[model samples]
Target chain A: MQYKDYYKILGVERGAGQDDIKKAYRRLARKYHPDVSKEPDAEEHFKEVGEAYEVLKDPEKRAAYDQLGSQWQTGEQFRPPPDWNAGYEYSGGFSGDDAAAYSDFFESLFGFAGRAKTGSTGAGFHAQGQDTHARILIDLEDAYRGATRSISLRHPQLDATGHVALRERQLNVNIPKGVYAGQHIRLKGQGESGMGDGQAGDLYLEIGFNPHSIYRVDGKDVYIDLPVTPWEAALGEQVTVPTPVGKVNMKIPPGSTQGKQMRLKGKGIPAKVAGDFYVVLQIAVPPADTDTARKAYETLKQAAGFNPRQHLEKQS
Target chain B: MKNHDSAPTLNGEVLEDYCLSLQQLCHGATAEPEFILQLVEYEVLVPQGGQEAEWRFRAEDLARLRRAQRLTRDFELDLSALALVMQLLDELMELRGSG
Candidate 1:
């Protein structure tokens, strides 16, 4: 067995406080949870993180691990000394279900089979199979108008010869309208095969949008930065703006301030539930290059005595 | 097996140039020749089979293989994880370029 550094795995220091350890574990657990995280190896990494937290969260287990000392490096061949855990009294009795879930190495050090005094009955006859989870990235436009995509997936198939073979299969999935990022869509009877006569579990597909070039998504609302000339912002004008659906004429209110947001009802991504589109005004100052343009800017700068920093001077 | 010593120097003008033979690449990667050959068998790596044993490798491909090897050996990341990382990185880069 290799020496595993539980503290390093959790990104916490060896002498960290109990509260800090608990906080870090909760944050990481939520991040790497199979349902939420997009990081690769989330499942395996999440398992390792959970196992590390399970041992570190308890003072008794932590003390036993610390006894191993700093001399043993990570991944080093390790075997616990005989009677190493001679005196520590464990407050909470060991649970076999947790032990079975953990690695054999962890089990050898602190395993307690038939220790649960409750004598809890195992999963009864109708045990639903564990749900399989996957995240699918879709185009932003697809959310506005629902789309059906044929996706290809590759899985390892165990043949009759016991050798693993690679197989490719296609699945047609219905992308619901108005599905936001981090939201999940459940596909019935598409998960891992069930044991015995049990029914198969569901496949949860978490939806994520491919970042858009012109738009940004914030929860249910969509925000777009629209650049307008200084004159257009000062004196209102009706201009065409592009949305996911199509281009529409939008009016800029007179004396519109820069960064002022305007809402267009039901113009954003049209999921089963619709969201509103927001346009943020950005006033662009024209750079004078030609002589006439320079003179025009000079006249405007002289006539329009708009001191942008008047408020700052007043405060001073 | 064409010796690495006998291989001519490439001027590096081309977008991608095959610098070393398949054997040299395997040895350089500290991987088995057969394991590298599996990529060729899968058409992941295109190699001309004959007495000359002509093998072509793009700079991008060489870099990807190096990264793949690092994920496997250094990080102990499994193959599925490596594939997912590659896909995610590609999508991220593509999104950035488009933006």
Candidate 2:
């Protein structure tokens, strides 16, 4: 596994004080907070920043981490020396589920709480695992109809000598239909395993939608802008529109102008209370480049009854 | 083609079908029950029970409570100010959605 530099991740020098480390962490946290940040990879960046903060925040963890020396470069292949954690003692309250997010390097040194407790052979020792949380990004179409997804989670395993081994377990999850963004799905008994007789904690996956170029969501409603020619807007025409479910024919009424909204009932997100899908009309005027087109435009101009700029003239 | 045996497939329940009660919400958010009750009183999380013991919160409320925890703990925001910020943020998101 590759060596991870906690100091480098936090953008702080080795000689920096605890206050400086905290200052740097807060700046990064605010920039990458999933709720507020507009960045494309905000969630990933948030998780990584959080991991760095978790290690650097505690004084004991910092001291232990610093003893590893500054010889190793980031991403260098590294293995911890046997008995590396000799003198210092860790009263590990960090449940295995808490350490599930950190990289293998962190797990190797500090040990996974989940694994440590689970592997305990001591009589009458029992501890419940901490619950874990993660965000899952899916396409909007997946919300309309259920889809299957595979995700790899980092976890710690116990070896014979009670050493922690970083393990990546992949699970195929079946996402149910009609789950909108911001809603969470609960997976019972899928999180960190309980120690002794304790019950395993649950896992919660928050849903987020991948950005779609054509459609946008509000609550359960879906919105899209449909382009129509000038003639089609003036004289009604039957048009085929695309929705998450499928394509359907929509009849545009006569004199349907630009900015007109047509609501398709029960076509938004499929939920208990289905939301309507809105089509916002945008008129596209063809350019008069050829002789036939120019003549057609001239004929329309001659036949026009009133000027469109009359409202502007009235305002002036 | 080989038959894929022993491949694990898991199905998760949606938030509407099964949600967290007051005690579970407290455990999940890592907040005390008193604070959650205060939030409920403030209408930050409008739960579906007449009493604290019977209150059940949806996933959306849980998400809001989590955010509220961070704002109040880290940023030191009062409940009233937090409510205003929440409203403004919701409006901002709605405006962005319209565009």
Candidate 3:
């Protein structure tokens, strides 16, 4: 296992006060919390921050971790010396239910015994297992046509001796058609197993769309920027617009300006109440690179006498 | 490790609008009924029916409820303040999506 420097992860000095450590944790947590943050790898960073705070916030754990010494660098191959935590006593069991979220180094030091004790030991105790949540990214095309997806989930299970181990399980799931972003697919009895005769919890898979090059989804509505020639926008034209289902010929209205949105009703995701597909017109101007092209542009400029900066001049 | 090729394809139901009961929502969110009730009192989550027993929640409500739980726990926010934050976050998401 690699040694994780909890102090360095939290961006505080090894000798920093508990109050200062807490302040740093709050600042980082606010910045990296996955729900609120837009940063890439926010979830990973948040988990690292959480694990660091878990150790440093508690005085006992902090003292025990400090004994590991500051000589060891972060990510260095490390093995805990026998009897490292001989004297210290942990006040409580592992704090969170998901012990698999923590790193191997942290688990090796303080995790095993605490987690083993958390498993239900009483003969008569029977309760439903906790439901688990996971987000899955699917293609927009998959929403149009239903598809099967293979997902790998890390499930924590207790052995016969009550030792918690993270077991990776692969499940093939049928994703229903018309599933949109923020929607959830509930797989019954796929979550944590219940104790004794109690029923297993359901697994809720939240659907998110992988970013597509040509499409942007807002709810069920899909938007695409279609490049149209200046003449095509000026004098209507029939253009083949690509949709999730297939390519369809769309009539571009005459006098269409740049950024003009044309709505195709019932053409978006195939929800019960179908959403509208919006085609935003982007007027593409041909470059006047050649002499003939330049001449044609010059003639049109002289003939039209059009100034696009009229609005700015009027405002000024 | 389980075999990937021979795994049975499990069919799942897509949770649609106003399909989840209060108990289902609570289980999905891993939150207490009291916490959900507090959320309702703060107007953070408004279900479909008048009575709590008859209430039906949307799939979106489950998502919102989870986010609410995380924000409240991390920031140690009160119900009223969390309600305000939730409203602002909803507006922010709307603006981002449209923009």
Candidate 4:
């Protein structure tokens, strides 16, 4: 395991006082907290900061850690000497339900004893397990046609000896059709198992959509940019457009401008209320590279005599 | 990684608006009824009903409550401050989404 420098993680001096350490932790927590922060990798940084605070906040843990000396650098190969913590006694074990979020270095030093204490229970004790939450990404097409997904989850579990270890479980889940983003799917009795005769907790999966090349989704509504030739926008014509379900012929009214939006009702996501599919027209102008194309453009310029900068000219 | 194709498929119930009861919300959030009641008093959660026993919450409430719990714990915020923070966060999310 690599040594993690708690002082470096919290950006404090090794000789810093408790008050200084606490203030630094609060500042970093505010900046890196997953729920509040917009920074990339905020969750990872937040976990590191939280772990640092967990050790630094407690006087016992801090003193015991200090005994290791400051000669070690972060990410350097590290192993505790035999009976490194023999003289120190920790009053309590690690707090929080997410001990698995900590690093191997942390678990190697402090995880086993504290976690074992919490995992142990008297005989015939029955308490329901804690519920679990996770987010799953599905394809936009899967939302329309309902697909089966195999998901793997890693969680902390206790062995027969009451030692906590990370375990992975896989489940094949059937995602129902018409599910939209921000929705939850509850799988009963699929979460953490109870200690004795208690029931297992439920698992809640929040649904999110993978970004699609041709489509953008907001709630249940879908949007796509449809490129059209200038003539198609200027003159009325029937054009084939792609929708989530399939391609359908849509009429482009005469004098349709660039960025004009057309709505196909009940064609977005196949939800209970059914969102609408929107097609925004993007006018693609052909370049006058060839002589014939240049001539055609010249003739159109002469015929139409349209001044697009009239408003700017009037303002000037 | 082991093959999971032979595993039986589990169908989950989609949690829609106003589909969760107070009891279920508590279990989903890992919170106590009194804490939920405090949230209701703070207007952080607006369940549909007159009494706490009869309240029905939206599925989204579970997520909202969890957020509230985390912010309160991390920041040592009171209910009033937490309520304000929640509203500001909602507005911030709206602005970001639209932009």
Candidate 5:
């Protein structure tokens, strides 16, 4: 196993005080926390920082690690000198959940020394299995009309010897109608493998819609910007608009202004829960370059007597 | 910190293995930092001085920078579009771990 230089990871001197170590950890953690950071390796960096703080933040662990000698190169072959931890008394051994997340190298040094504590249970008992998580992107139509999708997932399976092996399986998922983006679908027994005869953790599937050419989705509502001619907007017209389910006739209200939004009830993608569809009207002005078009515009301007910006009276 | 080779070993504790200076880490790893800077509103790289001015990078910084670069060059994403992708990636990872 490779050795990690926690000092280097945390960017601190070996003799750095606890407060210094903590301040560095807090600074780095905020910069790299997977949730808030946009750095590509934020997740890996977060893990490394967490691991570093895991050792250095604790006085006992830090001292024991310092005793290992600075000459031992990082990732160099390591064998803890016999009874290196002999006289060191570690108060409050590592909790069970944390021990499991620590590396084998860490576990080798600290695992055996800690007294495993399982509190307030039967003589011997365990609970709270690991949760399973997955992400799936479905088409907008799938949400509108619902779908039974065959999803293929590859997950790690640990062998009897405890080495992980990649295993693939196919599951048929029932996509409930009208599921919006960012929603979750949970399935039992779809997560990390269970431990010690315990029930498997729940699997959470985060919902995402594939980029659609015809639609833009916003939280239970769908918006499609449709282009209409000036004449079509001025004199109301019925046009065929594309909805998630199918193409339908939508009425453009008379004297509609440019950039006006029109709604089609119950025409959006339908699922178990349904959202409304909105058609944003974009007026397409006819080019006046042609003589016929220029004559038409001249006639209209003379007849209509319209002054679009007449309201803007500059005080200065 | 040196320009040792094009490929870095994926394992072990060598400087090349664990982390590298900014330039070495980003060498050919990304398209350019021009657009990525627009996304974060942060100037990603600054000169360290002399010959090393363009030669500094931390592993954490380089990894995400490279990923951002890939989303633009390899994935053909615009700045606004890349922001959306980055946002979704964060959300996706959270859902993955929590689930």
Candidate 6:
């Protein structure tokens, strides 16, 4: 694993005081907090900052880390000297459920084996597994119809040697139909494995939809732009509109104009309180390139006595 | 007609209509009841009943309280300050969502 310069990550000096480190951490955390930050790499940077703070906040962990010598370069292949942490006592053990968010470098040093909470479950030291969160992207059709997705998760495992190792586990998750964006699907007993016979924590999967070329979805509502000939828009006509389910014959009311929206109720994502699908009519005017088409247009323009720019002229 | 009943089905229930009891909210957030009670005290989460046993929480309550808890733990902010932070963040998210 490459060496991480925690000091550089936090923008602090080697001899920086604990107060300085704490202030730096607070400032950086506020700036890069994933919820508020709009930066593209905000979450990754936030995790890195948190990991750096995790090591530096505690003096014991910091002392051990400093003993590695400041001369070492960041991203340089690093292996801790045996017994580097021999003298120091890690009083404040890893207590948070976010150990999985920490890097492998952090795990190699302060991971379970040498840390206070290492396999020492002792008798009656049971603990439930940590709840894991992930985002699942599915096609719009998947939301209309349920789908089974295979997802992989990395979790800390307690091996026979009492070493903390990250294990990749895969589970086939069933995504229920009509799941809207930003909604979560809870899968019981599917997160990190519980320690010492405790019940496993549930996995929370946030649903997101892949961008669809033809349809825009909000909640359960779906929208599509339907192209209609100018003649069809001018006169009422029975048209076939494509919906998530399939094509259905729809009636275009008389006097329908461009940018008119028609709602097809109960035709959206199928579910209780089903949302409506909207069809926005876009008038497609025929080009008068050919002589026959020009003659037809000329005949209609003279006979119809319609001034399309009357509204624009009024507005100006 | 097609026979596809052999496939295992997954039933997903939407967290609407005052769903999610207090206990489930606590479990989902991996937070203690005491902290949530404090949130209720600070007006962060307002449940129906005064008594803890009769109190109920919505899925939104779970999400907001968990967000508050994470911010507080990560930034070491107090509940009241974090409540304001949560409020601003909520407004920002709504604006971004609409824009």
Candidate scoring better on TM-score of 5 and 6: 6
Position A115, candidate 3: lDDT? 78
Worst 10 residues of 6 chain A by lDDT: A112-121
lDDT of 3 by residue, A1-316 (tens): 8999999999999999999999999999989988788899998999899899989999999999999999999999999999999988887647755677788888788887677766756898888988888888889999999888888999867788776677988899888899899899999999888887889999999999999999999999999999999889989999999999899999998999999999999888988888889999999999999999999999989998999999899886
Per-residue lDDT over A1-316 for candidate 4, one digit per residue giving the tens place of the 0 to 100 score? 8999999999999999999999999999899988899999999999999899889999989998998999999999999988888877776667756777889888878888788876768899999988898888999999999998988899988888787788988888889999998889999999889878999999999888888898988889999899999998998789998876789999999999988999999998988999999999999989999999999999999999999989999886
| Candidate 4 per-residue lDDT over residues B1-99, each given as its tens digit | 233877888999999888888899888988888888999998999999887777889887888988998898888899899999999999998888656
Q: Candidate 1 on A1-316: residue-level lDDT in tens?
A: 8887888888898999889888887788657754336778887777777778778888998898788787877788889898887776565534322333455456456543223333232466444454444567888887777666655545433344433334655566767567776565656666554555677655555567888898988656788999999989999999999988889899998899999999998776665456789999999988898999899988998999888998899886
- Give lDDT tens digits, candidate 5, residues A1-316: 6667889989999899999998998888768876557788997887788778878988888889888878866787677778888888766555423333455566556655553332223534555455544556888988887766666666645444444335666666777777766665656666565455667665555577888887888767899989999889999999999887778998888899988988876666664345789999999888999999999999999999988877785533
Clashing pairs in 3: none
Error of 4 at B32 (Å): 2.4
Off by over 4 Å in 6: A15-20, A113-119, A124-133, A192-197, A225-240, A249-260, A280-316, B1-17, B41-51
- Please give, for residues A102-204, the per-residue lDDT of candidate 6 as tens digits: 7778887887644536566787777898666677788888888888776666876777777777787666667777777767777777766777888898877
lDDT of 1 at A298: 87
RMSD of 3: 2.0
Q: Report the C-alpha lDDT of model 2 over A234-282, residue by residue, as the tens digit.
A: 8999999999989989999999978999999999989888888999899
Candidate 4: Cα lDDT at A37: 98
Top DockQ prediction, candidate number:
3
Model 4 misplaced regions, further than 4 Å: A288-316, B1-3
Model-by-model lDDT, in order?
0.65, 0.78, 0.89, 0.89, 0.65, 0.80
How well does candidate 4 reproduce the true complex, by DockQ? 0.58
DockQ of predictions, in order shown: 0.01, 0.44, 0.60, 0.58, 0.02, 0.26
RMSD of each: 21.2, 4.0, 2.0, 2.5, 18.9, 5.0
